[model samples]
Target: MKKARLWSLLEDGRVQCLVCERRCLIRPGAKGACGNYVNVGGELFHLGYGRLSALESRPIELKPLFHYWPNSTALTFSSYDCNFHCPWCQNYHLSFRMPDISQPVFSPEKLVELAVREGDEGLSASFNEPAVNFDFLVDVAEHASKRGLYFMLVTNGYFTEKALDALLRAGIDGWSISIKGCKGMQKPLGNIDFYVPFRNAKTIKERGGYVEIVYLVVTNTNDYEDCYRWIIEKHVTLLGVDTPLHINRYFPAYAWRKPPTPISKLLEIAEEAKKSGLRYVYIGNLHNPRYETTYCPKCGRPVIVRNNYRVVDWKLEKRDNEWKCKYCGYPVPIKGEYIPEKKWLGLM
Candidate 1:
């Protein structure tokens, strides 16, 4: 366990955690709302700092980050628990529990070294909300930046402005932020402000970090047309139309087990997003290859072809510092170097 950051002491012998938007006021010997940080003698202590629950090498595509670095590998890691209490969380096994502090610790330097040793191009904190490990992430990102490797986070975007500023200063390269819908959905998710995610995404983009948004369509929950319109409008207005939007299909998991999201509904929303002038829209968690592939916005030609996370064909050419279509010469908004070869390294 390590000393936590972004926290302040309270007058009534309590401490407030400022890492995420929750602003949990933890009393002595008690845990925060996320169950990862504990108050020890009126001081805040991070129980999950440098302690990992899951670690493995995964494709950036698995992060659902198609535009940033296609077919590249990232050393992804996650700690236990989450600030949000989504009943239908697919990663319930990881998010529903607290960090096992009894287990061995993995230092930030060691994690960056392992990524370099394994020939990964970047590092990602995923599978669960990463805000609980904010201090550790900043350390790892600092080390990664020094070593010429990129660092990213797959988050629910519940972080406070202070935490987001620290991450930006640490050279965070990319983000795959999840948007669960607007204000009415906060009660089931620990009363978190729905606008926090969108706000942080805009801040990151304004600071020049790559970002992509993920909207998981749950059946009978946030699958309404108005909800989709809200997300699409926010994505365009805040981030811009060139930002890639991933509409994912949700399956029943954990407590709320209603039914799986229908494919027709997922497809319908994706189509609507495209008709609304989103340049890059993709469908995830479904086996339809056509939706997984990336197409040239102008020429309607496939620039990056993929079959279930593996890039099979790359038809774009780099010209004058931009990835352009071979047939139409339309510049695609692809960042970083395109890795031609890849190895499907399974979970460790």
Candidate 2:
């Protein structure tokens, strides 16, 4: 356990955690909403620090981050407990429970070394809400940067501005935030302001960090056409049309037993987003080569071809220090260097 960096002591043996928007006011000998923060002697402690529930090296594309660092792998991990109570959380095994201190602790330095040993391009805090592990992530990001590795978050974007600013200062390179729309439908998840995610996305972009939006379209829930339109408008106007937006197909999980999102509906939303002037829109989860491929905005040709979660082909060439379409010379917004030696399935 470690003393929380983003917390304050309150009057009468209480403390307030300022890591996320919840700002849980915890009493002595009590735990906070996420179950990872505890108040001890009028001080807040992060019990989830260095404790991990899941860890693996996975394709960065699987994060649905199509725009930032294509054909790369990240050493991704997550801890237990989440501030939000989403009934259909896909990772409920981790998010719905209290942080298990019994879990093996991996120090920030050890994690960064593991990433290096695994030959990963970066480290990602994912699986469950990462705000609970803010201090740990900051430490890991610092260590990862020294080793020439990037650090990022796959989050719900419910962080306090102070926490976000701290993350940026810690060298966070990118964010793939889930923006679940429909305020009424989100009541199950504590009715968190749906606009906050959009606002945070804009903030990340303005701060010069790579960002991608992932909207999980649950069946009959926040699947309305207007939701897609609103998200498209925000993506186009706030983050710019070139920013990548992922329309993910949601399946039955946890308490929510609704059927999977219709593939046709996802395709329709993607088409509509394209027509709305968004350049990079994709359908995730239910994979098809057509929906996963990244097409050049200018030449209308596939710049990167992904089959499932693997990059099968890369058609962009580095010229003038920018990734440009080989045929049309249209500059693509992909960040990081292309690891040409990295073995790909169907390298073009």
lDDT of each: 0.89, 0.85
Q: What is the lDDT of residue 290 in candidate 2?
A: 88
Can you tell me which runs of candidate 1 are displaced by over 4 Å?
none
The TM-score obtained by model 1 is 0.97
The root-mean-square deviation over C-alpha atoms between each candidate and the true structure, in angstroms, is 1.3, 2.6
lDDT of model number 1: 0.89
Model 2 CA deviation exceeding 4 Å by range: 183-186, 341-348
Scored by TM-score, the top model is 1
Q: Report the C-alpha lDDT of model 1 over 255-285, residue by residue, as the tens digit.
A: 9887988999998988888887889999999
TM-score of each: 0.97, 0.95
lDDT of 2 by residue, 105-125 (tens): 789999999989988899999
